[model samples]
Target: MTSPTLALDPAWITRTVAVALDEDLGPAPGRDVTTQSTIPADAVGAADLVARQDGVVAGLVVAPEVVGQVAARLGLAVPSVDQRVADGTRVARGDVLAVLTGPVQVLLVAERTLLNLASRASGVATHTRRWADALEGTGALVLDTRKTTPGLRALEKYAVRCGGGTNKRMGLYDVAMVKDNHVVAAGSVAAAIEAVRTRFPDVTIQVEADTLDQALEAVGAGARFLLLDNMPTPLLAEVVAAVRAVDPRVELEATGNLTLDRAREVASTGVDYLSVGGLTHSSPILDLALDLEPLQPV
Candidate 1:
């Protein structure tokens, strides 16, 4: 197994650990009495951070953040993630992402939380990579949707990028994506585009269309990209051909029920993007573990 590529956000690393500490011991005493009693104060320990499952790594940058926060909370200061592993790299069973050294009490307390972040982040990276790999030669970029963790949008999206995937709108403001409800509420795709365009002239307008005619309506309203929502492959090809025929400059994006097995065929239609909700909603997580070595008296 290759080494882990740690590219986690430093801010998140600190914040995550800080919050964990606050939740567990913001007002409580330091030095978990139970741990202190069981383990001698002079005992030193070492652990080999290893993975139990195969997956790409993301948010590895924050590993040290966890270690540091936990160490500090326990009144021990170990080096913060001394060396980082690369983000967006693959890891196999028994790979060492980083080396953490500190008091045994601190290490034991921080174990579950540390592994949790590493595993989940790497899972997202791995899941996104699979889809990106599936459409490797199709020239279509795999895109992520709004389906994301509540507070980890930045991290999750970072993972997707690490996996060779492109991001759609990071949030509501990054770009305007008008979907089925928006189009209907506005009374028409053209109306939604016109309204948004009238308000934000510089922003790219992407209106979702359920059918070819609706797609045409979106294009006519000066939409730069048309999202073909839930269209079958045959209809997708027809829509792509129609959009190009009407105005070759318009970009077409596909969304809705696109899976790894079917994405290649969809991308072959010359669509510019394909959005997958599963990257966040359904992707499996990577498995990682931390191993400890008995500290010789020093």
Candidate 2:
């Protein structure tokens, strides 16, 4: 399996793993009470991170780091995790994504945290893959919105990319998105575009248009990127034609109420992108489990 095209920052992964471990095990004197009481300190064994349901695999690379951090906090030997498949690979229910070996206590301590991160990431990827598949053969691309979990934006966005979906904007800092509120505050689409242009000349400005008139006004104000919010198929087609007539280079995105069943119909409207907020916010966690092999007598 080939690696994903997008790169995840090593420092970010390490920090995220550290923070997650801290949350689960607590700070400094953190301990897994059950494991500490039941398992012998020197008892060592192996376990497999197995999929309980068929889905795309993700977040395997971060598993080892989680194990190390949890073990370090517990004063135990860090477990080794070997990824069996690359992220984004289509996996079956029984597939092993990674193998871990270390003190039984350490393995048990890291299991839930590892499964939580990987399962959540894989769920987003799986949901996004369906969108990508539905939009196949259409020139339009699938994009994800800012409706991600509060702290898992980076991991969730990375999963989206792995599943062949594009990121619209990382945050408000990267691109200027003049939504309905922004337009209302600025008086009009033209005024909003002008204000954003004056403040951040180099940033790409995307204006939201609810009707043909607003669409045309945005284009008239030199905005080339437009988000066609919640417009029906026929109205979207009209807006597409109207914008194309003004400038063929303008990029149009269709968003709001975009579902998997409506992907083709929306894409057929000639919009350049279809943005889905559910990719991150409402995706269910992919089922995953860790099964430990019995430790042999030393």
Best by TM-score: 2
Residue-level lDDT tens digits of model 2 in 1-298? 1133766777888888877877887885587788899989999999999999998877777887888887778788888888899998999999988889998988998888888889999999999999999999999988888899887898998898878888888887889999999988989888888898899998999988999999999999999899999999999999999899999999999999888889999999899899999999999989999999977978
lDDT by residue for model 1 over 194-275, one digit each (tens)?
8888899877777888898988877787777888989899999999999999899988889998888898899998898899
Q: CA shift at 116, candidate 1, in angstroms?
A: 1.1
lDDT of 2 at 148: 91
Shift of residue 53 alpha carbon in model 1, Å? 1.4
Please report, in order, the local distance difference test score of every candidate based on alpha carbons: 0.77, 0.88
Tell me how many clashing residue pairs each candidate has. 6, 0
Instruction: After superposing candidate 2 on the true structure, give the runs of residues whose Cα lies further than 4 Å from its correct spot.
Output: 1-4
Model 1 TM-score? 0.90
TM-score of each: 0.90, 0.96
RMSD of candidate 1 to the truth, in angstroms, is 3.8
